[model samples]
Target: MKTIAINGSPRKGWNTHILVEEALKGAASKGSDTELVNLYDLNFKGCISCFECKRRGGKSFGRCAAGDDLKPVLDRIHTCDALIIGSPIYISEVTAAVRALFERLTFQYITYSKDRKTFFTRRVPTALIYTMNISEPAIESMGYAEKFKFYEDRFNQIIGPAKTLVSTETWQTTDYSKYEMTMFDGEARKKRREEIFPQDKRKAFELGAGLV
Candidate 1:
């Protein structure tokens, strides 16, 4: 078995990265070859509407054709068993990297012809992890969860339903005192980091193993 994780967070060791790493560990423990991809390290763009993937029986049919650093990744994805994508919410939506990756990954595989078939005939277990500055209660209040769920449903429609990991009210910096950020209660955020984050990692590990 092979499982790969892509993290769209710019920070190397931040919340989203940590969660994805945890999940990868789980997949590895289950005897799967696991890899962690940091999207920031890659240079790529979203689908350019080339429609090359729409060409019937062509080399690009039912696959991404964007030629860049992400192409090799897509090639691997075509044969991989499990996929995990995680990102920090930027203004209530996925980061540019994750959004671009999604556009390329999903649009290419989506066949618009009659029957609306997806490229993947077999269900590929997947995971979606999110890191945000908001709290759990505020997520539904802001309707952000629905937006995330829409993409989850999109993933399911293409491949399969994804297990999700959410880290909320994240600590943005090592020292909150350095910045002029009075909106958040530092103590509560620290409490979450100390108490809840460990459990979240454990959950991520379990999610990964289950996917395998």
Candidate 2:
């Protein structure tokens, strides 16, 4: 099995990236060849709506036509056995990079014809992981759950079987005093990091292994 993971967080060793790495480890433990992609390391644009992928009998039909850094990653995903995407919540939504990837990755396979709904050749297991500073209860109150479910539903429709994993109340930094932020208690955050984050990592691992 070939599993591909996309890390949509800008910080390489932070919560989002850490969870993504854990997921990849789980995939590897299952004897799957795994690759982890850092989205921020590459420069790319969202779907430009060129319609080339939709043209009847076009060379790029059923594929994203954008020629950029993400093209190769998308090409690999087209034939991969499983997929895992991880991102941190920014401004109550997924980061800008992840949003752009969503447009490029999902929109290409979407079809307007009544005869067909997606262009993906085969069904594969997929998972979406999100790390956020908000508490678990706040997810529903803030409508984040709905937004996440929307993405999951879309992935189920167009991509394959998809699951979502959320890590909340994430520790932001090792030293909070350096920043101007005072809304959070550093000790509490640190405590959660030490106690709860490992549980999240385990869940991510299980999610990845199950995907394979």
Candidate 3:
């Protein structure tokens, strides 16, 4: 089975990367072939809103028309059995790179039938991992959690139910001297790392192992 993980964090080895790596490790333990793509390392542009992909009688139907880094990645996403995406929240939404990837990838799958209605028909099982500095309560208060739900529903409607993994109230601004105090929530994070996350990771691994 094949699984593809997309790391959307600009920081290569930071929180988002750690979570994706752990999930991938679990997947590998189940004897699934896994690959990771770091978006910041690739050269890609945001979707240009060109109607070329949806043009009638066009050869690029069901594919992105723009020639950019997203083309190859989209190819993998289309064929991969399981997809894992990790991103650090910027403001109340995902990072720009991830958002751009979504825009470009989603456009490729947009289609219409004889009725002239648009819809997404291609199905891909997916998981979304988002880490942020805001606490869960704060996220709800700020309406970010609801925004996440919007994305979740959209993904489920377009691709499939995307298992959501969120790490909130993370330590982003760290100082060496008062590190212990700053990591007051370290124990909780550790528990999640050692327990909750591993379970999901194993599940993801099994999902990959069972894929065709």
Candidate 4:
């Protein structure tokens, strides 16, 4: 079995990356070949509106025709057994690189046939790892989780169920002493990091292994 993980964070060693790697570890432990792809390290663009993938009765059907770095990843995903995607919430949604990859990759599998109600026909099991600055309690009040829920639901509609592991109140900076914020409590942040982060990592690991 082959499982692929994508890191959407620009920083390779950040919380999102750590969680993705943990997921990969769990998948590897399950005797699956795992690969972690960092989108920040790749040069690619989102769907270019070429409409090549959407054309019917053509060679481009069910495939993204974009000739960029993303094409290779999408090609691999077309045949992979499992997929894990990790992203940090930036301005209330996934980062640009991830969104770009999502569009390019998902749009290819989108189907509008009369017999098909869902977007995609692929049956791959997927897991989403999201890291955010807010706590779980604030998710509903701010309605910030709705966007992610939409994506998750859409993924389920397209492929199989899309499981998500969310880490809140993430460690944002390497050195908190270098920044200034009166409202910030460094001790609480450290406390959460020490107390809760490991559990989240374990959750991610389980998410990966379970899919395999």
Candidate maximizing TM-score = 2
TM for candidate 4 is: 0.94
Compared with the true structure, model 3 gives a TM-score of 0.80
Best by the lDDT measure = 2
Shift of residue 90 alpha carbon in model 2, Å: 0.2
As a TM-score, model 1 comes out at: 0.96
Off by over 4 Å in 2: none
lDDT accuracy of residue 191 in candidate 2: 99
- Tens digits of per-residue lDDT for model 1, 12-88: 99899999999999999999999889999999998899999889878888778778999999888878999999999
Q: TM-score for all predictions?
A: 0.96, 0.98, 0.80, 0.94
lDDT of each: 0.88, 0.94, 0.74, 0.87
Lowest summed lDDT across 10 adjacent residues in model 2 is found at 115-124
TM-score of 2: 0.98
- Please give the distance, in angstroms, between residue 192's alpha carbon in candidate 3 and its true position after superposition: 10
Least accurate 10 contiguous residues by lDDT in model 1: 159-168
Clashes of each: 0, 0, 0, 0
What lDDT would candidate 3 get against the real structure? 0.74
How far is 97's C-alpha from truth in model 1 (Å)?
Answer: 0.2
* Prediction RMSDs, each to the true structure: 1.2, 0.9, 3.9, 1.6
